[model samples]
Target: MILLRLTWLSLLNRKATLLLILASISISVFLLLAVDMVRHQVKDSFSSTVSGTDLVVGARSGQINLLLYSVFRIGNATNNISWQSYQEISKHPKVDWSIPLSLGDSHKGYRVLGTSQTYFTHYRYGKKQNLDFAKGKPFAGLFDVVLGAEVAKALNYKLGDSIVIAHGMGNAALVEHGDKPFVVSGILKPTGTPVDRTLHVSLEAIEAIHVDWKAGTKIPGLNISAEQALGMDLKPKQITAFMLGLKSRLSVFHLQRSINNYRSEPLQAILPGLALQELWQMFSLAEKALMFVSALVALSSFIGLLALMLTSLNERRREMAILRSVGARPMHILLLLVIESSLLTCLSVLFGVALLYLSLGTLSPWIQSEWGFRLIVQPLTLWQWQLLGILMLAGSCVGVIPGIRAYKQSLIDGMAIRL
Candidate 1:
């Protein structure tokens, strides 16, 4: 109890230097905790991007490629599946429901997905959570569109607003479908996935926009009005990809195999869960790299604490003489230094934890709005508690160096000071 009181008083005496060291250690702790939290949250977000869909079927291509374009909206499809092929497989005995996706257009910088109303009913994300509207209802008209939360917020769009989609997948497109403008019929609530960044439209709307175009360009002297195009057939001939929910979990593999071996068209079907696992494997190295960097930061802060103690020891020689004159033993001085170091570490950890939660509370909403994923405020995980324990042990070990120095110096400089 005496040593602890003395340590606290000593730390308070050198407030400036000690506070600086405290800030450094606290910052390191914050980085370590933040990295772990983000890694897990990002993995959860990726895994739950689309749920309840057993298989994602697309034209013959790499599983990663199909998953990327179909679910993540990351890349363009290599080939589109014929509409006939979709119908044939969707009617399979095991298939319960299907959501067809037609990509290849953009509104501003966000991807425009052409899908059926079945998409709104069948698509699931984040533990089978259904899509909900933040503003209005789903599109009913051929020229109606529904905006994702991010798209609406970023573009400041509201219900009944008109927007034109551009050909291809970029913000800067040479051709715009200006003739057929779409009204904002709805805006979906944020799902913390790529769904938040997409604009939804009917599959027929995709075909209607290109009715007068041939070979990716509008035919010369052939301009089709939106009304005239609406009267013509708008059934999609092909689609980028489709997702399927099976009637039973047991039939998922069997149906996937059947679709992959379909004789009419070359197609590939992937289990969304397995494909997501593979995607995470590719990014595991990057996650480890981040953890490594955070560990180094923490290590450097401990090194700084060691240096502070060692440098302060010399100035405390007179103080040590006073204690020895009062019959203090070398072991007491050693234990004092250890207790002081432990106190510093504990206080730094407390400050770090407080800062971390404060920052999360302040920035969580902004992060969700900007990045589309909620920064979940959860209790420190067991692994995180273990990490804190390790940090405390490391800090205590660092004190041993200065403790040994003080122990040896007390013997030689008993009741005498060279200065």
Candidate 2:
């Protein structure tokens, strides 16, 4: 108890410098933990968005492009699959369920996904699962809207509210769908995928809104009422892509090959898991860059802590003389310094974690609203915890230099050392 109090007093005496050290270490720990968590999660998020699905089939493109456009809503699809091709694949014997998707538009920066009700009933993310509705029911009729959890919360949308859709694949200058508006039919539970930020409506809704348009612009002076739209056949001509689940997992490669060599128009089929792996490989470079940058920041912080303690040691020489005369051993003095530093490091790590979670909890709604990215404050994984422990140990070890110097100075000066 006496020794612990001595260590406490020593750090308390230099409160200003110690506080700076604490702040630096805290920022470093926070950044290290945050970067590690984000790198793992972004990849996990991308891969988890569509699991248990055998393949994602779309018009001819690279595997990475197909996955990004269909699953992540990252980029627009270069070509769309005809509705006839979707039906033909659905008829295959090994197929269990197929969800067709129509893309190529946005509303206030939110992705507009035109899909059948099976998307809510059968589509899964993270694990093999179905869409969970947080409020209201799924789309029931043409022009009905189903907001993602993020979309609903961010936009403050609820059931029966009306909203206008925008034209084009991005934040465009004009409101093309202003002539036609949609009623909020439902809001989905949070799934933490692109789905959470997407706006889901029926394929018929896609057809109805786009019937008179060509090449992403309205055919001039060609306007029709919602009633007239309802009267026309609402079938889709071209869909951006489709997801396929197989009755037999073993037949995935065979199905992929079949789709790749379709009779008339060329098509490409990508295994969701395989395509996800490819996508991750492409993104790994960015992850490495972030990790490297965060590591350098941590290194600088630890060095700052070391420099502060060493510089402050000069003022403590007389204090050390007093302690040596009072019968404190060299090891005891060394341990006092180590305990102070280790405790400070541990506190910084804990405080940093708290601050990170607090920030995320507060800003999560805003981030999802504007960025279409969900930030999850998950506890450190085992490996991540281990990495942090190693950093803490390294920081503490670096702190030992001051303790060693203090021990030597106390022994050599024999109660006469003066700063």
Candidate 3:
């Protein structure tokens, strides 16, 4: 008890240096925790982007490519599956529901997805959470469109607002469908996934927009009014891809094999969970790099703490004499330094945790919108607790250097004032 009281007094006397050491350790610990927590949350967010769907069926292509373009709204399809085949497959006794996706158009820079009302009613994400509307209802007309939360907010669009679609999938488009405008019928709630950046419309709308175009170019002098186009048959001949949910999980493998061996078209079916695992394997290298940098930061912080203690040792020679005069043993002085360092490390870790939660509370929404990562603030994981224990042990080991030097000086300058 006497040793701890004296150590507290010593730290209080040098409060400025103590605080500098505290800040250094706190910032380093903060970086370490943030890197680990954000990495895990991002992985979780990405994996949860598509759920409750057993397989993603698309034209023959690489599994990763199909998963990217179909679920993530990235890249383009090499070929499209015939709508006739889609209808036959959706009618399979094992199939519970199917959502067809026809993607080729863009609005501003966001991808426009041509789907059916089944999308709003059956599609799900993030642990089977169904799509919810922030305002208005699903599209009820051929010219009606539903905007994702990010699309509505980015363009400041409200219900009943009209917008034109471009004929390509990027900032620059070859042609514009300015003749047929879509009215925003609904705005979906924020999803923190690719869905938030998409525009949804009926498949008929997609066919109507391209009625007068051939090979992606408008036919010269071929003008079709929106009303006239709507009157014509709008049955989609082909679609980029479709998602399937199985009535029984046991039938997933059989359906996947059936789709791969279909005689009508060259197609591929991928299990979303397995594909997601493969995708994360590709990102493991980046995760290791982040952990390596955090380790280095922690090491640097401990080195700075060592230097501060060593510098303070030079000015404490008189204090060492006072301790020896009062019958204090060299080992006691060494133990005091170790305990002080351990206390500082504990306090700094607490401060770092407090700062981490504060930052997450303030910036989580922005992070979700910008990066599609939903960070959940929660207690430290088991691994984090283990890492904190290792840090405390390392700090005590580093503290021993100055502690040994203090012990040596106390023996040589016993009862004698060096200054």
Candidate 4:
């Protein structure tokens, strides 16, 4: 108890230096924990982007590419599947429900998705959570549209507001369907997924808007009015992709094989779970790189702490002499240094956790709006607890070097004072 009191008094005497060390370690700890927590949450969010679906069927392409374009809205599909193929596969004995996706359109930088009302009834995210509307109901008419929360907020759209669709898939669109405007029927609650940045419309609407468009441009002098287009055959001939839920989990592989080997146009069916695992594996390298950089930052902070204590040792020579005069031994000085180092590191852990909570609370909503990532503020996980223990142990090891030097200097100074 006396040694602890002495150590506390010594740190108080150098409060400025102590605070500097505390700040350094605290910042390092914060970065390490933040990186770890964000990495885990991002992986969770990615996996949760589309749940309750067994397979994603699309034109022949890489699994990751299909997953990214279909579920994440990250890239354009290289090819599209024929509506005939979609119908045949969707009617399979093992298929329970299917949701068709029509792409290749945009509304003010947000991807416009062409799907059926079954999307709202069957689509799931973040567990089996169904889509919920913040205002109004799903699209009931051919020209009605449903807006994602982010899309609605960005465009300042409300129910009954009219919005035009662009022919292409970005903000810099050249040809827009200005002649046929769609009314916003509903706005969805935020899902923290690609769905949150999409605009939903009926597949017939997609075909209707493009009735007079060909080769990525409006057909010269070939104008089709919205009323005429709607009355025409509006059935979609091709779709970018489709998601399927199987009646039997055991038949997923069999259905995947059948779809892949179909004699018609080349197609691929991927198990969502398998594709998600592969995606995570692809991201593991980046996550490891971030963790490595954070570990280096922590190492540098501990090195600074060691140097600070070692440099201050020379100035405290007289203090060591006074301690020895009061019957303190060399081992006592060593233990005191270790205890001080442990206390500083423990306090840094606490401060870092507090900082993380404040940062997450402040940024969660903004992040969800901009990036569609929900940063959950929760208690540490088992792995994070292990990491804390490792950090504490590592800090103690860092103290050993300065502790030995302090012990040696104490012995030398005590003998000189005795003489």
Task: Please report the candidate that would top TM-score against the real structure.
Answer: 4
Q: 164, model 2: CA deviation in Å?
A: 2.5
lDDT of each: 0.91, 0.84, 0.90, 0.90
Given candidate 4, what's the lDDT at residue 384?
89
Candidate maximizing lDDT: 1
- The CA lDDT at 377 in model 2 is 71
User: Candidate 4: which pairs clash?
Assistant: none
lDDT of 3 at 377: 87
Model 3 misplaced stretches (Cα beyond 4 Å): 1-9, 12-20, 172-175, 417-419
Off by over 4 Å in 1: 362-371
Clashing pairs in 3: none
lDDT of 3 by residue, 1-419 (tens): 99889988998999998898899898888888989999888878778788899999999998988998999888999999999999999999999999999999999988999999888878989989999999999999999999989889988999989999999888863578999999999999998888989999999999999999988899999999899997999999999999999999999999999999999989999998998888888989988998999899989999999998899887988887788888888888898888888888988888888888888998987886666566888989999888888888988988799999988887777778554
Q: How many clashing pairs per prediction, in order?
A: 0, 0, 0, 0
TM-score per model over all chains: 0.94, 0.93, 0.91, 0.95
Better of 2 and 3 by TM-score: 2
Off by over 4 Å in 2: none
Instruction: Give residue 171's lDDT in candidate 2 (0 to 100).
Output: 68
The lDDT of model 4 is: 0.90
Q: Please, what are the lDDT tens digits per residue for candidate 2 over residues 1-419?
A: 88778878888878887888788878887888888876776677676788778889999978888888899898878788889989999889999999999987777788899999788777888778778888898899898999988878777889999988887766658556877799999999888788988999999999899888988778999998788999999889989999998998999898889999998688999987877777777878988898888889888888888888788778888788889889988888788788877878888888888877887788776776666566787777898788779877977797699999988887788778844
Model 4 per-residue lDDT tens digits across residues 264-288: 9999999888998998898889999
